[model samples]
Target: MLKKLYLLPLCLIFFVPLIVCEKILILPDHLKNFWIAGVNFDYFSYYKSKVLLILVLFSLISLLYRLRKDEISIKSSKLYIPLFVYLFFIIMSTIFSKYKDISLWGFPDRYEGAMVLFSYIIIFFVFALVPKIKDTQIILNSFLISSFLIGVISMLQFFNLDFIKSYIVGKLHIFQLQYLGKVYIKFNPGPRYVYATLYNSNYVGSFMAISFIVTFILYVLNNEKKRIIYGILSVIMFFSLIACHSRAGILGVMVAVIFFAVYKYKEILKNFKFVAPILIIYLLVYVFINTLSSSYIGNKIESLFVDINKTITNSTNNNLRDVKIYNNAVCLNFDKATLNFVFDNEKIFATDENNKRVSFKFDSNKNEFLFENPTYSQLKYFINNYNNMPVLILNNGYDNLNLIKTKEGFKILSFSGKINNINPVDKIDVKGKEKLGSGRVYIWSRSIPLIKNTLFLGYGPDTYALYFPQYDYIGKFLFLGTPSILVDKPHNMYLQNAINIGVIGTLAFLIFILCYLIFSFKAINTLKDSSLSTISISIFFALIAYLVAGVFNDSVVYVAPLFWALGGLNFKILNN
Candidate 1:
């Protein structure tokens, strides 16, 4: 029975490929289009849940078979305290939740507590059971092969290679061509980007970032022959990353690179005399190739490096073009610029019916600008009579809604053409007023009051969004950006977990991160094997990258390939 353990690795190799194949097999159809569900299967349909249940059952059966045959030890304990906390919250949440029915199970819009619980459990299981280092190799090999195949396909699509396209289209029924499909010709001469088995460019960027880190780690450990092969793949991954045009993904990889340098700080200095010139040559080569690339690449690089301070003084428009300029310019002068633009520009200028001043706001980011009219804008016609005396002129100078100075000593604008007696700016109108303008700091601020309510057992997983609005704004800006957008999950994962299961859950999650850090640090110290050391170090760096990136994006909340890579590595480290 113990001998069968060897077969387990082979099974994993095949199993990993099968998963990859499943993704590839569905690509042509799912990649091009999206659907809610089948005609018979509506929202919160049982189909996806049933499939997950089957997989869980199969895994359990496999474990039992191994245990009965004495092929594997099924030693287990309450090893997942953090997960247990999450489960605890789910149950607690069932009682106080405004939407308990949806919270306990699945929702019409998205997954419920039970489904999220399983995601946590499955991840924890994979981390605890999957063996170290070897499993990482299997995953990496699968990624490399899968990415290469997809890259080849995208290239074939690029040249209008009709026969190949038709052959693939026929094979994959769902895939249709529109604007060069996954690999746009604008990026390069061939398949410039690798959408791979994912639907969106952002996913492609994320996958490439993780794969590139893996390739770099592998290259550092590879023999001469392997080095050449992996090195070429690394270059391919780099181009693929650039083609995705995902700023967050690029930032994530950059963080990983910085971590790599920091991890090797001592070694780097010790060998600086020998390594300095080699590093210089690599930099030179990279720059030379970048220079020869398309104008788009050159422009993007230039845009990345442009000085923000010099650009902000030149503009006031808040359209996408203006916003990009402003975003770059405000990099150094955010607060001052926002204030000047707001107050000086009369960003909130409106007039009441009695000719009193009302309020409004101007918000701009990238291509999106929010011009919220609390009151005044230009009227359609000139000053003709007192009856039509009031008008609104937005910064763009358009009057769609009625703005009036009322005799009731208040300035008001009816969202509709006709006036409504109800006041829209009442305290009840807004959400999360107490924590407004604080961004992620709202989580910390709001948590203090919530903990007083339930010190031992708190709210539930994903409960932050519902409770946050109870905290009113603090007379500043509205929560309009990153932290506010991610109100779905608390901006801080630690705080979110803590609020859900009280202090215990929060501590457990921290301990897991701490444990992984300590173990990886020790591995770096004791392992004289360069290959093992490089991979371990890279994994450590990648984890940090994800954490930092999470500050701005809801990464851990979603199941991206990066999470899988990180979990697999953490599992490997503990087992090793």
Candidate 2:
């Protein structure tokens, strides 16, 4: 019974990705409002947490039972110190948080608060304590199988397997066809990007990126026939990764490959004949996929270069010209300079050198500005004070603007407008033409300042959204079309941690990760068992890829557990 109980957690681990892939299996309106830990009691996250909690409890019970019989011995490692310290800080941060509920349970939108953190810690300890080679194999096999299923489904989606897509969508009613919106551009619309079972294509890419490395490592360790099979799986996952069209994912895989090569230079040289065939196969598959979808893939790659070049040469000149204001039955043309204050069709106010308020009435018939006390100086002041309004002064064009007063300063609220040909600026709506890092540069620039104020203790876990608004000036200008868009977390995971849990917490977390990596790599270097060493190195490479991708993306519910679980399994293998 105790042995069987251990299998339950492993089953739950595999079950997670399957349900998450099917879009969280959200409940209906009446049932959706049911809350747990302050988050909506959905099937995916809620059930997964419950299962993990049960697993933790069962593992504890089993441990106690074994302890009484003297069947097991407690083993300690260097990792426990930093891990416990990090958990301590997590508790302290949550307790002292201004929003304790949110800190403890996470925000309703993304439940990754103290509770989830606790669950992750529980999972880590469970694996670390088990210290069984067979258990480690079970976890790795489960991961690979789940990942393979995801890869196959994503490939089918990419090929427009409508029956499969329809079946999955029908089963998971939460899956929306138009979820991509502005993120992905569909030129022909068979399926521009494949999200597979993940929330977004980038997420699918992140998953596939890790899977690719794992599958390749399995191929490397397997015998002749098994190597051939694993090699095919690796190729399939690589293609699926490309289908996701995630530049960050591709970049991460490249980085991992470089790292692996540098680390295993001797092994590569010794096994050149084995590696060369896999490389050739990879190249052929790449060419075939690229050729099959030349317009989509080729254009995407080409646009990347164009966007990079544009960012380098793009000037920040004022391109807000031919500004048109419409009120009642009147339309008036104003130069980029001649817009002092625009308050969303409610009012227009401008001030002169004498601190005199100038008011303008729109003439319906004339379609021009009618000043109460018209003068050249007043007109000049109106133009000169254009900067005073909360309008976005893009180098490309002007957008309909609204002003809102905040504690910091005047913030812009923009409405969608078309860019004129005379002075067109690159708007954010032109999908695939975004600046490098997908506007992360601007987001990070605004977000970095908040860390100084909350250096010791942060706002709270999963409370980055609370502080995001104050630093969202660039977001407003960039996403003029989507005014309601809110960036809760900085794209970078490290930055998100720093903002949410403070510098000390972030440092502790980093220490834990570094220690895990150090220990795992050391084990891999010294292990005599080829299969064990290969698996260890594989997990390390996958983690490296994930971390590399994380530099451009924050941790999500779908991926974070997988990372932590795999890390824990590494610890288990090391101990064994």
- Which of the numbered candidates is closest to the native, going by highest lDDT? 2
Task: Estimate the overall C-alpha local distance difference test score of candidate 2.
Answer: 0.63
What lDDT score is found at residue 33 in candidate 2?
Answer: 27
lDDT of 1 by residue, 377-409 (tens): 211111111254333211223222222334442
Per-residue lDDT over 254-347 for candidate 2, one digit per residue giving the tens place of the 0 to 100 score: 8898988999888777777888899898888777767777757656656656655766774332222223332211112222233333334435
User: Which residue pairs in model 2 clash with each other?
Assistant: 21-197, 337-383, 338-383, 396-424, 396-425
Model 1: weakest 10-residue lDDT segment is: 323-332
Off by over 4 Å in 2: 1-5, 20-69, 162-190, 292-294, 298-434, 470-474, 479-481
Q: Looking at model 2, which ten-residue stretch has the lowest summed lDDT?
A: 327-336
Best by the TM-score measure: 2
Number of clashing residue pairs, candidate 2: 5
Error of 1 at 123 (Å): 3.2
